[model samples]
Target: MNVRPTLEEIRRAPKVLLHDHLDGGVRPGTVADLARESGYPDLPTTDADNLREWFEAAADSGSLERYLETFSHTVGVMQSVEALTRVAYECAEDLANDGIVYAEVRYAPEQHLRDGLSLEQVVEAVLDGFERGGREFGIRVGTLVTAMRHQARSMEIAELAVRYRDAGVVGFDIAGAEAGYPPTRHLDAFEYLQRENAHFTIHAGEGFGLPSIWQAIQWCGADRLGHGVRIIDDIKVDGDRARLGRLADYVRDKRIPLEMCPTSNVQTGAAKSIAEHPIGLLRRLSFRVTVNTDNRLMSGTSLSEEFAKLVEVFGYGWDDLQWFTVNAMKSAFAPFTDRLELINGVIKPGFAQLKWSGTRPLA
Candidate 1:
């Protein structure tokens, strides 16, 4: 039988988050404060605790349409450049506190343009905020310019991301309902990003199926998959053994990372529950699986909380968490040198302390 590590031990483990949404991870109090500053008074709940519960319940409704409605409330207040900057800064500070050595926070610029903020202005403001927070908290953060899949401006958003590639924007992505608005629909955008030699991750198989996952990788040329928990559906498990499909074989062989968010997957109905998630199976199969909190406020989780849940459900130990953290660092779009620096400087030392504590390493 596998042994579950204590919460204290898991909390001390180093972590990397490759898939987090900036607006989705906003603190409820920050949203309330921003709402007050912006004079937007239509929030379902005014109190921070109540507002958080409200977001979680809405997102857990099992309907992607209703789940997306919660974002409108959070993004509604994040209109002005000041609001964006503050929220972005707070996200970095919070992630650092969660012990995430490296993270890539994604947000759609078009969603933040309702208040007359240009795409360029929004990108610059967010970068400024991340830089300030990084200096204050001493964590490495990058931005992934996201384009909404249902929207027709994906090509434009992709270009904007590549245009600002050197200005803190690390990659590109397409998020939103993944069923009808498939990645194939945004081929132009993906094609443009490829031509510019830019990297991108796609949201697939969260609310959809293997076809969505296939198209995102085979058709759209994605470097990583966002909420790709459904890739497990392609694997044929026979008792203690499992077989992989052609697509799964390709993904595993190429080491295309799958950004799996456990709590969020359960809350969003992607996974039935934490115990049922395929993270452990995928990890054992050597699929470059990295854990993340898709939305902290909505899932009521941090990186530590995620690590803790994995321990409770799958009996993960310090070594398992370390492997996941390193997988995330390897999957990050950060430059090779920067990635190595984080691994050597932050991740290695943190795990070394844990190893020296005499916890039995996973065999």
Candidate 2:
């Protein structure tokens, strides 16, 4: 039998994160410091501990407005170039310390225009931070430039992504509420990216249903689905077997990656709880699923903690974790050669060592 790995042991394994938000993972202490320095006095409490508790509590509040208010404060403090660069640097450092071998962090450039920084300035600042942090921390960092789906600036953002494609900007994305603003609303942007041969993912099927995901893939040509929890709705399961609908079949057959965020899903009522999450069924059904920390600060989770929760709920061992890591690495926006190098070089070796260590005492 495969021994279930402990959280600490899981933390030591090499992981690949494909979906993380740059602003969503800001450190509370850093948020507090930035707020103080920027004189952005809208924080509920400048006390880091209290601010942390507030964010945690607010996510669980089940109010959309309150949940969004959290980002407003984080974005409020992150107006200047220095603030953006520092947050990106610390984001890379924190992920590296948590044993992430590779990650692609994303943020919207339009949101940071309040402080007179040009869109190019915002992208440059973030890229500079990731470069410095990756060098010092021994992790590879790539960036995804995100455009809010509700806004009409996606064409500009898509152009921005292609503009900086060679300079650590690996991909593009569209994010925001999925209710009134559909992914197809930004079809021109997606089509533009497709024409440029640029990779992009769309926020879909989290707060909305099948049509959102359908359009994101079929219409917008999304390379991946962000928070694609509702894809579960298309599958009907009997005790031992599940039937995939046309859309679900297409998603699986094409190997489209679903970036699943468990705790965040529960917080937003997408999933009832971690145990009841669709990931278990999706993993069993062999869908291309990749685990992610959608918002580390808001979800109160890391990539390791996300895997540990899967272990506790589904009884996953090192092999299961390795499968998820490999899936994420394969689904990454980086080149095939680079992805293969990490899979064969860092990830496989790290998992092999951990599997051995995790079972040796029993032997």
Candidate 3:
């Protein structure tokens, strides 16, 4: 077994990613190609490198609307079945190259229907791409069908998720603007999923406050909290210690998973800085904290960059990385058998290599 290791070694360990947007991870060059194919102009930059910087700058402006605009160009090109398949395939390939062993890439099928493709067709194409990529690269991939919060078709989307449960679709999710569109607004969808015994996650407490998180868990019955970063609002800290309020206590006592994306949180103004992120505090508190890349292209980050950022800012070691890796495995949408296999066969062996080296396992 691989024993004590350096930080870079730990950071390179095989990872399980529970949060990443399919449209958000498109490479700038891929985006340019998609835009060109669709004859869609208005990209902030034409060159791949410059376009990457442009997306990052626009997202860093702290304007949610501007940050979201980047996806318009991506989704524009992904309207066709061929485009969706290619992007989804490349997403898995890219993650595998980054040392991600298993990843669940989420996307709103409704967004891709602009080209008149049915929701079933959209799901099929993405799942096909994921399967193809996984077989070709030996990377495990899953899909979370996301229903837009601002849209009224959540029930329809929820049904679609259940319909494809046996396929590559692993779970259902509700994402989009979280302000006025509280999880309660999608009560029908949530209730339906609950009745069908389907699992789901909700994007809450990112740009909003405690109420959003509360409704997501207590009202909407979310199995996990996406960007639950704002759950910090309910926490009070003293020096290096912290106290949790009633809601936070429930979340912790229940061992609910929080998908916290440091770089994306900073870009969206959810967290002031990496050092100030609630993830560090939550991790110290023994919360089931898992790191994620909420939006790779927009935030100009990868799972590797995210781990590096945490290591640099928090001085996290191999143990911390292992803890996060296990947390993600425990909270994955995959089946119990698959989850156990990943933890035992993949995560454990990967961590063994890192822990064997004394240097920081993440570089």
Candidate 4:
């Protein structure tokens, strides 16, 4: 009889996350605690459960702009160095407990500067937290310093990323609403990273269309596409046959990793539902697709939950899960040697064990 993997099995399989946001993934209790400590007065609720519900409800508005508005409270409480460090540490701990072996968690350093902490201080605090969490939990955590695209400090943030490349920071990124604030506006940042031979990803094709992705790649040279969910707009599938547009062809041909966040995409109206998400088709077409949790708190998801949903919706099994996990590790901004080490030494063996011990039925 054909059986599916259980949720516990899914949690035991080593996973890699390439596109998680630090600010957006804070725990609800932590958010309330931070708010109380910082004396931030704007939180809608002090009860942790209610606060979590508010975040999820606020992000369910179907407008990307409205969805992003929920971050103001998260970012608000994260202004101090102590708060940033604690959040980063907790992010690593949470992901490790959720069976994530490696993750690239991102946050905008500029947004955390409201309390007079310098950019360097912000990076150091986060790195300290991640290092602490990694050591305690026996997991690997890397940071991606992001710049807000609507703002004019992308070049500065790019420089910050390069400055800390050998430190804990692994990559650079520009994230914000994708309409009026196109990625081309941040070309200088991408160019600077390229000149320095640093890695970076762009939040494209999520709230925008192909042009955003084109500029992010052809013009800006992104290492990965953050939430490149809109690539489906350029693809047409006909039963067993499929057609790809020029952009889609290039993306697939180049093996550009699409950091797909299914639940978050549905919450933001990027995809209609879990079953209708483009991830299933993209994975079938063999695009370098990787599942991620763009925002854990806002979307109420984890790496295991993301994989479980795919298994239930698309009938994905252990092999499919391993493929996505390996794809993410390969596309991680960490050094190639480190990625290979984890893939061969940790991820493959972990999934292999789960497949071999297939006693528990899928839930």
Candidate 5:
């Protein structure tokens, strides 16, 4: 007989995160404190608990646009160098405490320039914070500098990513509403990154359909798909048999990583519910499916919480959790040697203990 793993057990599992956002995962209390120090009085509530509830409720409006509105408050407070560094440092500490041994946190450098900070300064501050936090928390953190798809600074952001490639910055990304602002609009950035042999992922297939995903992959050549929940649209299930569309076949055949954020997908209406998410089918089909928390604060989730929910809904066990963790580590933008080191040294060893403990069955 197999027993369900406890929350504490799940929390102790070594995890790898590849799709977290720095601005969207700010601590609620930190938001209030930053707002007060910045003299920004537009917060709905200064009470940390109330603010948290507000963010979750606001993000649950079942519309991606409305869901994104919650970021205004968070991004508003992250203009200065001190605020950016604090948010990044705390992000590392929080994920480390959540048992995430490695994470690649993304944020738009352009969004934090309101206080007249240069793009270089914005990147430097975040890298410094991640360095400090990683040293203190014993967690490895990599930064991905993102560009807003709705805006036209992607090329510039890509340059910044390359400039800091030897630093803490790992990759470039284009993230925003996927409907009107297609990934093709930022071809210059993707082309630039490709020319320089840099890595990049595009936000696609979440709020949009197969076309969005098709363009991101075939057109923009994304290294991974961010919140690619709509990849389900390209897969048709007939009883026990499943058929994949051309795009879906290509995605699966190529083993492109889908950074699926189950809770955040539901909050943004990309997924109807956790039980009905495409990740289950995708995983079973051997797609390169990696679990993530697109926005922890808004979704009120951590990587551990994400795995725990999957366990409850899909009856996942140590083997399943290890699969997703290894997928993420393999798909990470870091060097192949680094990825291999973490997989063998940290992730596998950590899960091996849990596996032999008889907490749950492999299946």
Candidate 6:
């Protein structure tokens, strides 16, 4: 009988994060420093605290396109190899401090080429950072190389992913506005990845609708759905019972992981409010729902904070937290042996310690 976990207890619990963005979680102070070093003048403010507030406020727009616009500043400062490596290192450290035992942070290589670094150079820089940071922080970090959906380089990026698959890069992704750039537009890339036998997740159903999700899974063959909150559109609820439509049923039956980033969904108007987020219904339906932080700096959140919000809004207990963590771990791009080791060795024991702190006769 695991009661609701306190924020402190939750902070200490091992968590798995899958949807976090690399450029989206930069430390504010580092952004300022990198901007100064890189001579990028686009930052709204050099003061770290003010910059943090600016990112959060700017990203609160109810449009995913506008929300993505905030990334320009963060990505602006991360250009050179040193800048990218430092950002990746700090990202690993931040996640570790927040008790995220394992995470897959994503970034677009094309977005980092403004300063003349090649795609391989960009990947190497980030990999170096994650490797060093993981070693220092005692956390496992994997990278997902992303291509901008609106761009025509998905195949290039997909090849890059495979070229470095055995390296720290674990998967591939396509991000940016999901409106005009459906996953099917990159069918060639997805097919290439499949032939290479590489894993990948797609940014679907966050800024778009059920059609977008359908294309990502059925057409593009994504191993996981990023911000799949929109799948609720296919689910009809009547009183305490619910009927899942064909697509929803298919998703659930296939156990396709839905990386649900509640705060980011609410910020981007994908979900109206945290209390009413589809994760509640999706979780109840056992839709392979997993919690995440799409952008920690933009959302002013960490994995623990995201769990805390669910605990506050949905009355999620330690059991629910453990379930989400395990779902994310199982859904991770990490090797099955690695994922199993963490789930059994770290996640389960961590939650047990928190929820079963003491023994007394319950009356």
Clashes of each: 0, 0, 20, 0, 0, 0
User: What would the per-residue lDDT of candidate 6 be over residues 1-363, giving only the tens digit for each residue?
Assistant: 557777887889999999999999999999999989888988989999999999999999888888998999999888899999999999999999999999999999999999799999999999999999999999999999999999999999999999998988999999889888889999999999999999999999998999999999999899999998899999999999999999999999999999999999999999999999999999999989999999999999988999999998988888899999999999999999999999999999988888888343222
Measured against the true structure, the TM-scores of the candidates, in listed sequence, are: 0.96, 0.98, 0.95, 0.98, 0.98, 0.98
Off by over 4 Å in 2: 63-65, 360-363
For candidate 2, write residues 1-363 as lDDT tens digits.
Answer: 367888888888999999999888999999999999999988999899888888888877654445656799889999998999999999999999899999999999999999899999999999999999999999999999999987899999999999999999999998888889999888888888989999999889988899999999998889999989999999999989899999999999999999998888888888899999999999998999999998899878899999999988998888889999999999999999999999999999999988876543322
Displacement of residue 271 (Cα, Å) in model 1 is 0.9
Candidate 2: residue 194 Cα off by (Å): 0.8
lDDT of 1 at 275: 84
lDDT of 4 by residue, 1-363 (tens): 235776777888899999999999999999999999989999999999999999999998878999999999999999998999899999989999999999999999999988899999999999999999999998899999999998999999999999999988999999989999999898888888999999999999998888999999999999899999999988998989889999999999999999999999998888999999999999999999999999999999998999999999999889899999999999999999999999999999998888877764555
Task: Tell me each candidate's RMSD, in Å, in order.
Answer: 2.0, 1.5, 2.1, 1.3, 1.3, 1.7
Query: Cα deviation of 295 in candidate 4 (Å)?
Result: 0.4
How accurate locally is residue 362 in candidate 3, as Cα lDDT from 0 to 100? 40
Question: Each candidate: what lDDT?
Answer: 0.88, 0.91, 0.87, 0.93, 0.93, 0.93
TM-score for candidate 2 = 0.98
Clash pairs, model 6 backbone: none
List, residue by residue over 68-145, the lDDT tens digit for candidate 5.
Answer: 999999999999999999999999999999999999999999999888999999999999889999999999999999
Ten-residue stretch with the least lDDT total in model 1: 1-10
Compared to the true structure, candidate 1 yields what TM-score? Answer: 0.96
Show where candidate 6 strays beyond 4 Å: 358-363
